[model samples]
Target: MEYRIEKDLLGEIKVPKEAYYGIHTVRACNNFPVSGLRTHPALIRAIARVKQAAALANMSAGLLDRRVGDAICRAAEEVAGGGLADQFIVDPFQGGAGTSTNMNVNEVIANRAIELLGGQKGDYRLVHPLEHVNLSQSTNDVYPTALRVAAIGMVLELSDCLAGLQAAFQEKEAEFAGILKVGRTEMQDAVPVTLGQEFSAFAEGIARDRWRLYKVEERLRQVNLGGTAVGTGLNADPKYIYAVIEELRAITGYGLARAENTVDLTQNADVFVEVSGLLKAAAVNLSKIAGDLRLLSSGPLGGLAELKLPQVQPGSSIMPGKVNPVIPEMVTQVAFQVMGNDQVIAMAAAAGQLELNAFMPLIAHNLLQSLELLINAVNIFSEKCVKGIKADEERCRRWLEESHSFITALTPHLGYDRAAELVKKAMAEKRLLREVIIESGLFTAGELELIFTPGELTRPGVAGAKLLEKKG
Candidate 1:
């Protein structure tokens, strides 16, 4: 490919003639090739929006020429609208605390702007990247603000996915309302609970996750877009600072506000930690739910066998007719990944130095990945797994009757000692609690049927007490 020479402070470098990215991006590619992953598309669009807003704000402040601002805004819009996506080539892991990312965007926008103005791509004379496109902006302000924007968008998407997942569980809850199953604590049968009740708990967890994820937007909406360098608004004018956020709000349609204390917003990375912590909490819930699904669906012949997940594929190469709970397993793995990303985000946020966090790139990368992964995983789980689950009503009934734990529910009617003695007798005889209770002749099968109704089985506190009261 034909190449063009671009000069920076570190001398001349050759860039592809057709490439919008220039010297800084090339240097970044060379310096940080650790992860071949490029910056997230959401973040790239967010940065373009920041650049567009800065142009409009600077032009309003009379600091940028109208012609230059117009050209830059047009080019920035192209990038923001999803054009020139391949031009953002910098790796997610880079030095200078996202300066490489900022310059990559700047160079691409400047070159594209130059072309729009009927000038050659390398003609910085028409649209200089740093002098015109990035006027009144700093990496410190631009990068973090863009991260906030992208994160808010991702969080909204994740909330929607969570809502869908919750609905899936709600549907299953209604479907399995009549399935009486044995509940276990510490791998031992504890009590009888309807399969619907178990699914209702899953739905409740996802509902909580959705609400918590939605609230993160409130924290992310406050940003330091014009607090150039160190958040003191040192190089950026006050008018530009105020106008920039307004332009950003209008462009992105987010309820964004400039932080009252830009320095605090700039220097501290605690918000990212808080966001990651919330993500970790969501991950925890997802992991637990996934594990429970796996456990419930564990065996067609040898395990709990209480649930049957949709068989999307064959499970084993060696075993015949084997199918697995692959979707919940997938959800479990994604949860692990999100949880790991949270740790990375937490540590990166805490590793920032004074005046400016030098680890913003690391934090942004992990946080964004976590959001994207969760959005996709939760949606897939809802669509493919939760929606397709089938409860084995017969199996549920058998397990509930076989376990002595069901005797606990009869304790209010039978005295505690009698219940305990009956449990031992049932175990010793290898008979079901229902059989032993029937033999005792304290109540008929018809009375036991009324006592163990679906609502009565799972409802909290003294479930069958009224049966004995009526008998008295």
Candidate 2:
């Protein structure tokens, strides 16, 4: 089948009807399968923004007729609503300077617009892809601009997830307020602390992640739209830049502004790297929390056994009463993937040599995949692991009471030499440190009781209250 050529301000380009089909067009079309990663939701959303901006620009410029503008706007609205996002299956890791992905979205929006106009597929004869749909944009500008908009959208979702997770930890903080366990340092018991303090620390880590995501979103809000074709604005009208940015901000509801230096915007992808790094930090925090949960829930028979994870599924094929903390395990795996994806993003960002970053497809794939995974992982961790977590209060108290390391807290009052002697004797005899302290003549039984009370040791104010109230 013969195909027609379409010319833009750049030059004439031939796209075959058989090979270059509409958005709904799919075949054995596997030639440009570079990254094999599909275009991200952020990229798709950005494409919608591009379409919206083009329509608005044309309407203002008196270039596009109202019928064409309205058709493009309506189609763009559908794309923005994510109706046509699934059709954008171009591999994110493709070559052709992201032209394939760009053209893929263009084709989809154009065909959808054509249908809206009561026209047939490949009916760019009425609403040309370059002339009407793409308008005064190039892949260089549009792809990156869409990327910025999409990143902002994703960051917003991540923000919500982080907030939810943070809140979940905060709730756990309240639930475990009085539960005391032996704190570990260098993997050895150190002192007594309320489990609430641990949960509060987890919440603080998530809050830091939330702050980093917000900062990354601020950088992503600066887009490269007006930097048409190598940041020169060669063929684009002077007013196209500001007008498109305004329209995109309205369309996306993000605080998007034009890049201060369009040349730098076109060439640099460091913002993506910064965002990816923040995601890595967030993933690390997640993995740390997961590690804590797994350790806390390690054994009902052998391990620490200080806390009980909510049992969601059976743990073993052979064991009858077995349960596992699968949610934290799954979150740990997600964190691992996020960390690896960050490496990919770092490499892609660094591979940008001179003019422009050619690895945008990879950058977009890794970054978006990280964001999506983290959001889902955070949701799962909050709902399955954190919200359902219950303090094993009796077990916690037993561990705290049994731990010889609580002697460290008494050392301040008993002197380090006496405390060390008591610990050595307790370890040798396998007796409770409280019992050893009382028997060793370092303190009387009543004095040992006063100093070794779990309530006073874990809750600072309790010790103060005992001293102030002259407890019997």
Candidate 3:
């Protein structure tokens, strides 16, 4: 391939003649090959947005020529619109507190802007990356600001995805409103509850998560965009500092505000930690519900057999006609990964020192990863799993009839001691509890029917008292 020589502090390096990225990006690509994963697409676009805003702010403050600023704006807009995705080749994992990423972005924009102004690529005389494109910014401010912007977009998308999951649960609740099932606690049968009530609980939990994500966006919106090197606005014009955030808000269309205490925002990575914790919370809820789905749909013949998940694929190679709850399993695994990502985010956030967090790259990488993971996971769970779940009415009824837990309902009618005795007799004889109660001559079959009807059993109040009193 044809190449151009570019000079930096480390002397000269060859750059691809046709490539939009320059020497800094080339160095970053060679220096860090840790994760095969590239900078997240959202983060790439966010960095472009930050560059565009900075150019505009500089032009407005009269520190930049309008002609240079316009060319930079056009090039940055192209990047923001995903024009040169191949140019951002640096891996997500790297040292230097994200300086590598920041410089990589600056060089790409500079070369692209040079090309736009009818100059050759790598011609810094036309558009210098550091001197023009990154005029009044530092990696300390630029990286974190872009991280917040990218995170906000993903958080909002994930929140909406959770709404889809919540709606799926609500649909199931309505579909199963009258289907009674035996609730379980600690792997033992508990009492009667409508399948709908159980789904309603799942919906409520997700609703809470959706709300939390929505509220957390506010915290992310507070950025340290104009803080320059150390959040003290060092070496940056006051007018440019004030105007940059406004430009950023306009460019990204997010309600972004410059942090009131930019120094505090710059040095601290706790907001990302808070966001990661919420993601973990959502993961916990999802893993729990997915586990429940797996349990409820455990077996067709040998297990609880209380639920029937949709069969999307073959379950086994040796076993005939075998089906599995694969979707819930997928969600559970994704949750586990997100849980791990949360821990990584926590450690990276806490590892930050004074005046700036040197671990922003780690925080940024894992934070965006968790958001993307959850968004896809939740959408899949809603569309592929929760929406397709089917309760086994026959199995539910059979389990309910056999469970000794229903004895609590009959206690008011039979007294506690008598109820315990009836359970023991039923268990010893290997007979149904209702049959043993009938054999005891405690009440007629008609009275037991009133006590055992699903509508009565799932609701509050003594099982047969109201109906029997009316009969008397």
Candidate 4:
């Protein structure tokens, strides 16, 4: 519990003598106690990678002391490896467009690098945080670049999780491919469809989501790494500016490129808005599929009872024998949150004034949170719900057979007006259409039988017509 004094333009402050973070980070901790949430570890790792790339670039340009640069590189490597995660204490909701986060990384790397040089943590004479650690950078450029890097990693993870979910749905589609169920529109039975077909649609929606997630990565990979201080490159050396981006590409193994219009990249946060919109679209699809699963698996008795989601936990404490679709419910909640986060990102993106978006901390926090939540939700939904779902074959068959929508199959033969009248009469009388059709004497029983087979009814091409042609 020892301390040392570190001063900035504001004033001097006592920093823990052993803390890798120095006065600036301490100031940030005191200033922004807003969220009580720490910056994401992914973002911290990305910032450290930026610092590592900057150190290497500085050395390559002969702008830094070789021993000092080497030490800084080693410190940054450790931080990027997540060795010093506990030392990053700034809240994600801070002001100054993530300057607090940027400085927090700078101070931590500078102090640790000083230790590697056999100097005390607070010894600025050996390694100054601002002069050495923060060379050729500004929060305006570095923070957003780091955010992009972090987001790229997160998006990839979510994409993988979504792919898993899509595959789970496809597996279920195959499992239930033969189970005939009634399709509905406006809550009324319209026609017959296979349970497998419903799940195939779900998988297709998620496949589109996976494709969208992949496409947005290219947008994020265009970064303003060399555009220090409002994209003018400012006091940064030209050689360092050009070389740092290449070093960053090597460090991250991402296809990162410096922005073609650095100033526009610095001033506008619209790309994050675009990414959030795409996430919102995916959330919509997830929510819709979850809602459908909930409806299809509603009750063992009174509901559709066509699907039985894996019971993960007891649905109620007092309602005996209750098992809820908690996995899909959880995914629905995640979708709600993602939709809300998209709004936050939109407002934050629009709130940017001239040279920089002062709202980046909020944008970064919400975007990363959305990604993490979606990844977890998708993974759990696949494992706990979709993978274990079972179709009620008898229930699906009964509903499909009982529905008056079977009149659809006869429309081509009996004509639309006659089929509509037959459907109305059968539904009103609570009579099976097969019995009604047989009693009505519109077609022979053999022809009706051929037309009403599950494959002939649900699939294209009329088996009854083919039967008639062969008979002739």
Instruction: Identify the superior model by TM-score, candidate 3 or candidate 4.
Output: 3
Collision pairs in model 3: none
Model 1 TM-score on a 0 to 1 scale: 0.98
lDDT tens per residue, model 4, 1-472 = 9999988899999999899998989999999898789998889999999999998999999988989999999999999999888999999989999999999999999999999999999998888888888888898899999999999999988889999999999999898887777999998998878888899999999999999998899999999987988998888888998899999999999999999889999999999999999999999999999999999998889999899888878889899998888898899999999999999999999999999999999999999999999999999989888999998999988887788767887777779999888878887898988888888988778887777666886777754778767766
- Score each candidate by Cα lDDT: 0.91, 0.80, 0.90, 0.90
* Candidate 2 Cα deviation (angstroms), residue 410: 1.9
Clashes of each: 0, 1, 0, 0
User: Per-candidate TM vs. native?
Assistant: 0.98, 0.91, 0.97, 0.97
Candidate 4 overall lDDT versus native:
0.90
Q: What residue runs in model 3 are displaced by over 4 Å at the alpha carbon?
A: none
Q: How are the candidates ranked when ordered by lDDT, highest leading? A: 1, 4, 3, 2
Q: Write the per-residue lDDT of candidate 3 for residues 6-117, one digit (tens) a residue.
A: 9999899999998888888888889898878898888988999999999999999999999999999999999899988998898888888988888878888998899889
The local distance difference test score of model 1 is 0.91
Error of 4 at 329 (Å): 0.5
In terms of lDDT, the poorest run of 10 residues in model 3 is: 450-459
